[model samples]
Target chain A: MRVSYYPGCSLEGTAKSYDISVRHVCRSLDIQLEEVPTWACCGSSPALKMNRLLSTALSAHNLALAERQNLSDVVAPCPFCFRRLKSAQEEMARDPALRQKVEQTIESQVNGNLTIHNLLGFLTERVGMKAIGEKIRKPLTGLKLIPYYGCYVVKPPSVTCFDDPANPTSLDEILRAAGGEVLDWDFKSECCGAGLSLSKPEKVCELTGRLVRDAAWRGADAIVVVCQLCQANLDLRQREIGLTDKKEYQLPVIYFTELLGLAFGCASEQLGLDRHFVDPLAVLKRKGLA
Target chain B: MFRLTGALSEQEFLHHVVQRSGQNLLECLQCGKCTGGCPIASEKVSGPRRLIAEILSGMRNEALKNPTWWYCVSCGTCMTRCPVDINMYQVATALCELAQEGGIAPSERDIHLFEELFLKSVEKYGRVKELRTVAAYNVITKNPLKDMDKAVTLMRKGAFSPLEILSGWAKDRKVSRIFALARRTSEGGHE
Candidate 1:
C-alpha cells in the first residue's frame, strides 16, 4: 500500500492540515506515503496561462524524476498540481517529439521522467472506499457534507482521467464511506476561480462565495474538498466576499482527508480542525462524531 | 455593421489570422458539446462553444473582442466533453491575451480589486496569506456586514482563533526557489 507522494507547494504551506491529515489517515490505514526524494512545484495554473510548453516541461521534469525512481504512480493531493502533472504526462506520452523536447527541458532543469496520480484517485481506486469505511471508528452521523470537486480533479478528462467531468463520484463515495451524508450540489465541479485567485481575487471571492453559500444553503454542515487552492478560496475568501457583497454566510471548508481522520477516530486537534477559518468542531460535536 | 464586399474566403481568413492553440480550432466540430457541458453556459453571454464557433467561422474581430471570452473560468468541462478534444479553455484564454494586447479597457473594478488583493499577498509575503488576503479584500470591498455573526460564533467556539493569522509566515527559501523556477519557465509570469 505504498505510493510515491508529491506534496506540492500549497500542502507544504497553507494546506499543511491536508498534508498532515492525509499522512495520518494513510498511515492508520496501512498505506505508506513515500515522499518523492526531491519535488518541485508543478507550475500549476500560472504556467498554463503564461506558456504551455514551459509549463508542460516543468511538470514533466517532476514526472521524469518519478520515472527515474521507478515509481510510475506519483500521488499528488493538490488539484492544480495533480491536473498539471497528469496533463503533462498525458501530453508527453502521446507525442514522442513533444516528449523529447520536454525530456530535454527536464534534463536541463532536473533529471527524470514522471507519471502522476491524484491522491483522491489513488485512494479511491487503489485503496477502495470500503477499506476506508472499515477504518472509521466514529461514524460522522448527522453531519451533512458537500463534496466539492472544484476544477482540477475532473476537468480535461483526457489528461486527468480520474472521474467524470460533469458528475464525479469519487469524493462523494469516499465521504459516504466516512459515515457522512453527501449533498448533491451543482457547485461541486464548479470553478472556484483557483488560478485566478491571485490574478482576480474579487472574482474568485465572488464565485467562491456563491459556491460556499450554495452549499450552506443546501444544508451542508461543511464542504469537503481535495484541492488546496479550492479549500483556501472557499474557506478564507468566502468571508471576505460575504462582507464585500453584503451577504452573511459561514460554511466551514474541510479537506476530505481531515474528515477521514475524524471518522477514523482521530482527535480534532490532531487533524488541525481548530486551524480552519471556519470552525467545524462544534458542528461535528453536535452530530456527536467529534 | 458594414459588410466586406470582397473579403477573403473563410479558409483564407483562418489561414491568415494568427490562430491561438490552432489545434483546438481545427478540432472543434460545432457539435455543441462544450455548450452542453459548461456549468455557466446559461449565464448572460454564451459559453466557450459559441466563442469557438465565431473564431472558426472567421469572425476574427468579434471572437477576439468578446467580453464573454474573459468570462470563462477555465473549468475544463468544455475541453473534457469536446469529441475532437478541443481545448476550448486554452482557446478562450488566448482570446483574452489578444484582448489584453489590444489595450482594451481595463477589466471591471471588481476584477481590479481582486488583482490588487492578490498582488498585495504576493508582494508582502511572496505567496498567498489566506487571512491577510481576506482581510485586505474585505477592507477594499468595504463590506463587513457579512460573516460578522459567523466570525463571532467561530471566535467564541475557538475555531476562528486569531492565531491562524498571527502564525502566517513567509514561504521558505525552497518555495522561493520553486517560484524562481516557475518564473523562468513561464517567462517571469506570476499567476
Candidate 2:
C-alpha cells in the first residue's frame, strides 16, 4: 500500500486541488503515499519538445530518487509527469545506450525497475475496485459522470503500456464501483488541449468547448478527470469557452479523486472541491451527496 | 569535381528526421490514418500525414517551418491509429528541435516562444513556478492581463501564491545540472 509519489509541478500550483484530493483519497483508502524528496519537474511537454535526452533525463532523475525510496512502485497524479516518467523507464529499460546517457545526464544510477502508475492505474490495478468500493460511505448513487481519460495517461501504447489506447475502461470501472453512473462517451480519451492553453487559449477553449458541450448533451452531472490539464482546461476555461461559443455551459469538471473522496465521506473542503472554477458542489448538492 | 551547396539531399533529410524521431518514417504508407485521428489537422495544417509526406519528400524547410507541429498538443492520438505506429508527436518534436537548431523561423512563433520560456523556467528553477512563468510570458508577449480573470480566481483559491518565486523549492542545483548535461550529451557528445 506504500508507494513513492511524484506530484509534478502543476500539482503544486495550477492543479493544487488534484494534489490535495489525491492525498485525501489515498489516506481514506489506507494507501500510504511517500512523496519523493526534493523531486524536480518531470520535464513535461516542454522538455519533450526541446530535447529527447532532456525529457528522458529529467524523468530518470525523479525515478532515481524514487528508487532511493526503496519502493517498487511510484504514482504520479499528473498524466504529463506520469507519461514522461513511465516513458523514461521504458526507454531506459529497452535501450542500454540511452540508459547510460540518461544516468550520465542525471548523475544518478537509474535502475528503471520501479513500476510507474498514473493515478487511475494506482487506484484500479494496485488498490483494486473491491478495496475502493468497500470504503465508499457516501456512495455516488445519483451522481452521473463521464470519465475523461484525456491523452497522456493512456496513449502511444508502446510507452504507457497501460489500458486500452483507443477506449480505456479503468476509470469507468472505478467510477462505477464508487457508485456513480458512468456514462458511455466517445470523447473519454480525447485531448483537452493541455499546455496549449498557455500558448493558444483559443484552441484550448475550442477543444474544451466540445468536451463540455458533449458532456452536457449526455446529461452527465459532471466531467470526471484524473489529469491536471484536463481538469484545468475543462474547469478553469469554462467562462472563456462559454464566451467564445456564446452558450451558457456551467458543467462542473470534477477530479476523479475528489469524487472518490466524497464517496468515502471525506468533507468536501478536505477534497479541495471548492477550488474548481465551475462549482461542482452545486451539482453534488443537487444530487444530495454534499 | 563540383563544390557542393549546404542543402541536405532527400535521403539525408529523411534520415535525419528518422534518426531524430526514432520512429520508422519509412514504413508510413501515406494512408492518412494519422490525419484522420489528428485533432488539429485542418485545411491549412495538413497534420501528421502531410508532415510525414513532407519529410518523405525531403522538404526539410516545409516540414520544420510548418505550424502544424507547433500546434501539436502531443496528444498521441495519431500514433494510436497509425498503421505503422509512426509517432507524430515525436516526429513533430524532432521537427521543432531541428527547426530551432537550423535557424528556421517557426510558423507559430507564440507557441515556440512559450515553449522556450517554459524550458527557461525549468532550466533556472529546477521546477516551474507556474504563476511566474505565466506572468513572464504575458509580459513578454505584451499581454500582461491575458489571464487576469483566471489569475485572480486561482490566487483566491490559493492555487499559487505571488510569493512562490521566493520559495525554497525554486532552487535545485542538481536538476539544473541535469539540464546542462543533457544539453551537452544531446548535442553530439557521442562524437
Candidate 3:
C-alpha cells in the first residue's frame, strides 16, 4: 500500500519519535509512504484564528501541492494537519466563492482533491484490520492501553466525518486487531490542554496529569494516542504531576504506531522506544515483551 | 443623540464575524449550553456562549478585550455539544481575531505576542522553526532570555532536537507568495 504522507512540522521537530515508529511500523506492514512534496505549514489554530482567508489559502496551497502528486490519497499523521487540510477541503467543497479565491491565490486550479485520511483511519480502513492483524508477530497479549482520541483526531463530525464524535471506536478497534487489550475510559476524547502548553504550562500539567492519573486508576498500562500534541503534552508533563500533588504519576505516554511497532515485533531501538520522556519499556518489560 | 465612537456598526460587525466564522449569530438560541459544557469556564473567562450572545449587542469592546478568547484551546467540545450547531470554536476564534484587529486583546498579551512571532516565522521560512520561533518570540515580547533555563532542561531530557534547526526552509517558495497575497488581502489591500 502506498499513499502521500504529510508529516507536518511537529513530526519533523519535537515528535520525531512518532515519525520514526510510524516509518518502522509501515515498513513492516509493507506500506510505502511518499511524503507530500515540500509541504508548507498547515496554518493551525493560531494562524487559522487570525485570518480565515490566509489559513484556507495556506491549506489550499498544500492541497494544490498534493494534487500534483500521483497518489489519490494524502495521509497526515498529525491530527492538526489532518484537520486543517480537511477544513480546506470542506471549505473548498462548500463555497464556490472561496474556491475561486483560493485558486487565484495559488495560481493553479485545484484539479481534484485528495481524500484526507488520519493515521488511525488510514491504518484501520485502508490497510484493513484483517491485514494489520496478519502482520502482528509479537501480539500485545497482556498489555492494556487507553486508545486516546484527543480533541482534533475525531471530533466535530461534520469536519472529521469519521466515527461517532461522542464515542469513537476506530482506535480501540485497531488496538484490539493488533492484539492489545483496549481499556474503557471516559477521558478517551478529552482535550490534553496542549493548546495552552506554552502560554499556560500549569494548566497543561493539570489537565495532562489528570488524564495520566485517571488512566492509571482505571488499569491502563499506558496512554496510547495518535496526535503529536497529545503525546508531547502527556509524555513531557509526567514529572509535572508531582508539582500539583505529592504523588508522581509516571504513566508512559505511548504513540499508537509505537504500540503497533511492538506488536509487529520490531526491536525497541528501531521503533525509537528509548526516546520517550517518561520511559515506556517498563510496561513492555512487565508484559514480558521486552 | 447617539455617537458612533470606537464601535462597529451592528451590520458591519455582524458581517465581519459572519464572513470569517460563517456562524449566524442570529441563530444562536441563547440557551448557554456552550457555557455549561466548557471545561475552562471560570470567573476570568465566561465562555463562548456569552461572547457570541454579546457580539450582536454592539458593545463588542468588552467581549473583544476579555480573557476568554485567549484561554480558549479550540478543543471543539462546545461545538460538539451545541444543540444549534453554532460552531462555538469558530465564534470564539472570530472574537479573538476582532480583538487582535482592534488592538483590544487586553489579557494574555504574551500569547498574542507569541502568535505574532509564530506567524512571522512562517512568513519567513514557510514553516515554524521551533527554536527560531521561540527565540524570536522571547526577543519580540521583550523577554529575550525568559525561557533559557527551561530550554536547557528540556534539551537535557532530549525534548529539544537541534537536527531540524540546522535543516531549514522548504524547497518551494510558492508558500511565500501565498503569504504575501494573504497579508495584502487581509489588510484590505493596504500594501
- Could you say which candidate leads in DockQ? 2
Positional deviation of A222 in candidate 2, in angstroms? 0.7
The TM-score of predicted model 2 comes to 0.95
Task: List CA RMSD, all candidates.
Answer: 5.6, 3.2, 3.5
lDDT score, candidate 1, position B108: 39
TM-scores, all candidates, are 0.76, 0.95, 0.92
Q: Which residue runs of candidate 1 sit more than 4 Å off their true CA positions?
A: A108-115, A198-202, A237-247, B1-47, B57-71, B92-191
lDDT of 1 by residue, B36-73 (tens): 86655555657776776676577867776554545565
For model 1 the local lDDT of residue B90 reads 63
* DockQ-based class of model 2: medium
Across A8-101, the per-residue lDDT of candidate 1 in tens digits comes to 7567556778888999998998988888665666655444543456567667766665665565567888877788777777776676666765
Better of 1 and 3 by TM-score: 3
Lowest lDDT 10-residue stretch of candidate 2 chain B: B1-10
Tell me how far the alpha carbon of residue B130 in candidate 3 is from the true structure, in angstroms, after superposition. 1.8
Better of 1 and 3 by DockQ: 3
Q: Give the per-residue Cα lDDT of candidate 3 at A176.
A: 90
Q: What TM-score does the first chain of candidate 3 have?
A: 0.96
Model 1 vs truth, CA RMSD: 5.6
lDDT (Cα) of model 2: 0.85
